[model samples]
Target: MSRKASGFTLIELMITVAIVAILAAVALPSYRSYVTRGRIPEATTALASKRVQMEQFYQDNRTYVDAPAGNNDTGTSTYFDFTAAPGGAETRTATGYVLSAVGKNGMTGFTFTVDQSNAKRTVVSGVPGWTDTTVNCWLTKQATSC
Candidate 1:
């Protein structure tokens, strides 16, 4: 025998590239979902803190109407837009109110709500690979209700 080729053939290189592509295709979505879930706690924590603030205001005013206008943000978030609910300047009723967080940036298709009754819920999502239970619960994990 003379000598074997020391370098990879064109076909071998193409096969390696194809394998990498398949791995990436499978991994990218899982990594993206994990990142999304990480950002979600920010919204929930802000909402909880805002709820406490609302309760304090209610204790003093005895009505949710004076709590905060709908345009006033409960708190700041980079990945979420916090609105007092209804996303307008209208005031809520004296006995009840709702606060919601809408996703921003790369977090579209996510909406979370909390009410004066402390009810937490995640709206049905339109995102691919996400399954919303629509059961009046927050989804802290992938397709899992909280």
Candidate 2:
């Protein structure tokens, strides 16, 4: 009976390992960027949903001053303080919504900004490594865009 080869040569195995390492090194950052990009939509969707809730609060409570009651699963039963500066928690007023979607708390990424009064929204990656911007792709109501 013929004997079968049992294992790879050391050089061949090393080369394969090195190639895989190189590919991973090249792909990791890109993958992270893609992930971060995906998160932008998540954050924006969350913001929009929150805005709708805030509007609903205004409709039901007749004022935007009170934080809504909490829901266990959604994590959005309360109002986000829109009073924070550009990159803080999303804020909403009875008349409009204002907030940023990324790069919060020193996170390095893009951010979504919505200035309801001007009907302006944008995505900004503040620095090259930090994608900071607004998600301006979706909008609702004349008072806001984000």
TM-score of each: 0.83, 0.53
lDDT of each: 0.78, 0.48
lDDT of 1 by residue, 6-121 (tens): 99999999999999999999999999889988988998888888788888888998877766533566346777888777754354777878888888877777888888899998
Per-residue CA lDDT of model 2 for 28-80, tens digit only, reads: 97775665555455555655665566566667877554434112122332222
| Runs in model 1 lying further than 4 Å from the true structure | 1-5, 68-71, 87-91
List the candidate 2 regions with Cα displacement exceeding 4 Å. Answer: 1-6, 60-97, 102-107, 115-120, 126-146
